[model samples]
Target: MPADVPGSRSERTEGAARPGGVASAPEGGPSQAVDSVLDALDPDRDRPANVIETHGLGLSFGSKPVLSSIDMQFGRGTITALIGPTGSGKSTFLRSLNRMNDKVVGFRHEGDATLDGRSIWDPGTDLLDLRRRVGMLFQRPNPFPMSIRDNVVAGVRAHRIAKGKQLDVVAEQRLRKVGLWDAVKDRLHDTPFRLSGGQQQLLCLARALAVGPDVLLLDEPTSSLDPISTEYIEAMLAELVPALTLIVVTHNLGQARRVSHRTMFFYDGQLVEQGPTEDLFERPTNLQTERYVMGRFG
Candidate 1:
C-alpha cells in the first residue's frame, strides 16, 4: 500500500559534503592544492564516477527505525525527487545520504553512504570537505547576516578557498547562474535579509554555488515563495540539473512532474516505487502510486 502524501508542496531535507581543496589558494593561482583531493572528490572525466550510493542504509531514533535497508543511487546531471507522506522517513532518508543525520543527537544509522565510492561513515572523513561537495539549500533562505557579497563568499572563506576580487568574481558568476545577478547586482553591500523572500533564497543559492559543488540538495526550496517565486525556482532547477546532481524532496507532485527526472514514492519508511518521471506519473507501476497521484490518499 502507498502512503498518501497530502496534496500540496511542503516536504524538505537537509545536509552537505565537501569538494577538493579549492579554498586555500587565492584567485587564479595553481588549483594544485585541490589536486590531492581531486582523485577522491573530483568528477573529472576519467574519475570512477558515481556521485552518491548508499548500501543497506538504516537509521533509528531511540531504536525506532526511521529508515530501513535503503539502497539508492544519485548520478551526475540528474534530478532525483523524494516523495512520501509527511513523516514517512522521506526527509530522514534524504539527510542520511550526506551524513546530516550525524548531527542529530541520538540519531543513528546502521549502514553506509558513499560519495565517489568513499564511505562517509569512515572516522577520517572530513565533514567540512564533504559538505562543500554536497551543497544543500534549505526550505527557507538562511543567509548569514552580512553584506550579500560577504554572505556569498562565506563558504569559500570557510573552505580556505580564494578570497577578495576572485571570490567576488565567483560569487557574481554564481548569482548569474541562479538568475539573481540582475536583481541584486547593485546591492552587493546590502544585508541579505532585506531582500524579498524569493530574492534572499536565490542569494543563498548564489552562496552555495560560489563553492562549486558536484551535487546540490534542495529541501522544499520553493514552499515559502509566492507563485512567481515558485516558478522561478522551478525554472532554475530545470536549468541547473544539466550540470549538477539535484535531489529535491517535495510534497507537490506537480512540481515533481515538472522538474524531476526520476521520482521515488515512499510509504511507512519504505521506498514503494521509483522510476522515470513520465512513466511513474502517467502509467504508475504500483496501486499506491496511482492513488497518491490521483489524490485518493496520502
Candidate 2:
C-alpha cells in the first residue's frame, strides 16, 4: 500500500502510537492522516473556490434547540469529520445543510446555511436541486427494493437526466467509482438483497454519486459494516474528497483521526472546537473536546 494513502494501516503517528493509547502526542512533522490528504489533493484541478458557510446557525425542534450558534466555514473539496458524544447534534447539523430537517414538524432554524454562497433556505431555492447537489448517505446501507442497476441510477432517472446508453454509462461509471462494478457487473439485474452488507452500502454510495453531487454528507456511513467493508468505504471516501467536499459524522474518534483532514467537536448543541484533525485529536484546546477525544466519556 502507498505510504500516503488515507487509511493506510502502516501510516502511524511517530512513536507510531495509534489513537486511544495513553501515549504522548508526536511532534515535529505533519501527522500521518493530514499528510495523506494533502498529498491526495490535486493542484491542477479547478476546485470549488466557493465555501460552505454557516452563520449563527441554530436549530430547534418544537422549542428544543439542538444546534446553537454554529459559525463555521468548510472549504471546498476538504474532508471534515464531525465528532462528539451522542445527542450532540452532529446529525442534525448535517441534515440542515440540505434542509432534511424540514420533514420534522415544528423544526425551525435561525441564521443561514449556504452552499457556494447561495442560501439554502431561500423560498425559491429548489429543494430537489439542493438535495441533489448535497447528497447524503445514512448510518446503515439503505438500498432500495430494486435491481442493482436501477438503484444506482434512480436519482438521475427520476430527474430525467439521462436515458438508454447515457443512463447505462452513468450507472457503470458510478459503480466503478465505488469499486463495486466488477463484483456486480453481471448481476445488475439482481435485487440489492443479493449483495453482501458491504456491497449494499457501496451501492448506496454509487446511487449518490451518479447525480454528480458537490458535497457528500455521510452520517456514520460505515458504522454497520464489517471491518473489511469499513476499510473499502474509507478508501473510497479518501479518493472522493478531491472532487467533492465531504462532511462526515462519526462517533469513532479513531476513525476520525485516521480519515479526516479537519475535525469539529460538538457538544450539547454547540460547536466547542474545530481545527486540523491531528491538532484537535492530539492536543485538543477545549477541555470538553480533550475528554471526548480521549474516550473519557463518549
Candidate 3:
C-alpha cells in the first residue's frame, strides 16, 4: 500500500470476517490474505485510469446513515455529473471528496476515498494541501469581502503560489480564463459584492482555478445565473476539461447531459447507476435510474 496506509495487509485483514462468515484466512493462514493485499497494492497492477476513487464508501451523521456502499471512480480530465433528488446524498458525497465533512458535527465515514491511489484520510496527508488539490465552487456566488482582484488571488496568495508582480499576472490570467477580466479590469480594486451575481460566480471560479487544482467540485454552479450567464459558465466549464477533472452535483438533468461525459444517479442514499452520459440517459440499467432520468419519480 502507499506510505500513508501503513501496516502489512495481514496486519490489517487478519481475523477479519470473509464471505460465508469465515473468521480467519484458510489453511494458508494470513499469507493468503497478504498475497491478496499485495496484488491489490501492486504498483504495476492494471486498473482503469482514475484521479479519484472510492471503495465501498459510506457516510453517516451520528446514528443516521446518509450514504452507503458507494464504489466509484472519476476519470482524470473528465466531467462527471451527479444527478439526484434533494437529500439523496449527492452533495454529501461531493463534499466528502475534499474532506469538507471532516468538521461537520457527527460526520463519520467508512471505507476510503483515494486521490492518485493514496488514501485521502491518510495520517500523513495535509488537509490544506488536499483541499488545494480539490477545490470547490458552491451553489451561489460567494465572493470574499475584498477587492475583485484580491478575491481572485485569495487562494493563490494563501498557497503562496505567486507574489509581487507575479500575483498581478496570476489574478489577470485567472480572471480572463473565466472571461471576467475585460468586464472587471477597470475596477480591479473594487469590492466583488458590487458585481452582478453571475460575474461574482465567475470570479469565484477564477479563484478556485488560480490554485492550479487537479480536480474541481461544483455544486449547482449555474443554479442562480440567468440563461445567458449560465451559457457562459457552461462554455467555460467545457474548456476546462482534459486539463482539470470536474465533478458536478446538479438537479438539472439537461445540464448534466449537456456538459458531462459520465453521469451517476443517486436515490435514497444509494448510487443507483452510473455510466456514460448518453447511456445513463437513454438506457439506464437500473429501474430507479430509469425512473429518475425519465422524470417518473425522484
Best by lDDT: 3
* Tens-place lDDT digits, model 2, residues 28-132: 466656544543563423433545889999999997999998998887666789998999999999989999999899999999998878889988899999999
Full ranking by TM-score: 2, 3, 1
Regions of candidate 3 where Cα sits further than 4 Å from its true position: 1-48
Error of 2 at 219 (Å): 0.5
Residue range 121-160, candidate 3, lDDT tens digits? 9999999999999999999999999999999999989998
Tell me which of candidates 1 and 3 scores higher on lDDT: 3
What lDDT does each candidate get? 0.77, 0.83, 0.85
| Pairs of colliding residues, candidate 3 | none
What is residue 39's positional error in candidate 3, in angstroms? 27
Please give the RMSD to the true structure for each candidate, in Å.
10.0, 7.5, 13.3
Best-matching candidate per TM-score: 2
Please provide TM-scores, in order, for all candidate models, with all chains considered together: 0.83, 0.86, 0.84
lDDT string for model 1 (101-195, tens) is 78777888887888888898788888888889888888888999899989888999899799777988878888888888888889899988889
Look at candidate 2 and give me any clashing residue pairs.
Answer: none
Segments in model 2 whose C-alpha atoms lie over 4 Å from true places: 1-50
